[model samples]
Target: MSAKTKYTDEPIGPVKVIPDFLPPPEELVFKEDTVKVTIALSRESVEFFKREARKHDTQYQKMIRRLLDAYAVAHSKAKQNEITAKRPARRR
Candidate 1:
């Protein structure tokens, strides 16, 4: 940053309208149903997630939960595709 930078107080041109590229407010409010359960994790795994979560400024538990959710979604899609491919085609 320079101390001698020039700045102007002139009025700007008319604002251009841009299309909104965001989901609706109602649609954005997603409430995830969660269950509390006790489980044991390895020391190394816990440490790894904790470090990464600290770097990202988020809770370690949330990071772990999102990771598991992504993995489940990937496997679920693969299983669905495999089943679809194995099914015989219908005749008209």
Candidate 2:
């Protein structure tokens, strides 16, 4: 038997679900240097980011850029360490 059937014999009626929509305010203009990026994500994660971005009054792309920059710095440091480790030991 399915888990739903095991848990409850009756069907659950209309669970109040929240709609995922953001109404942008008027007079919003993006700068010329700004570039648009489309990232593929699961529906839930996208909604989470959208909510967080709305809370901060900043675009999701800006938040993603900041995160990417931090990730890049850490990744570069790890790569540098790996390169250094591969070098042969020098004798005096």
Best by TM-score: 1
Query: Residue 33 CA error for candidate 1 (Å)?
Result: 0.9
TM-score for each candidate, following the candidate numbering: 0.68, 0.49
TM-score of 2: 0.49
- lDDT of each residue in 15-50, candidate 2, tens digit only: 998653332455235442556777787888768778
Candidate 1: misplaced stretches above 4 Å? 1-29
Q: Lowest-scoring 10 consecutive residues by lDDT in candidate 1?
A: 19-28
Model 2 worst lDDT run, 10 consecutive residues:
19-28
Displacement of the residue 32 alpha carbon in candidate 1, Å? 0.8
Whole-model lDDT per candidate = 0.83, 0.71
Native-structure RMSD, model 1: 10.1
Q: Highest lDDT among the candidates is held by which one?
A: 1
* Residue 58 in model 1: lDDT: 93
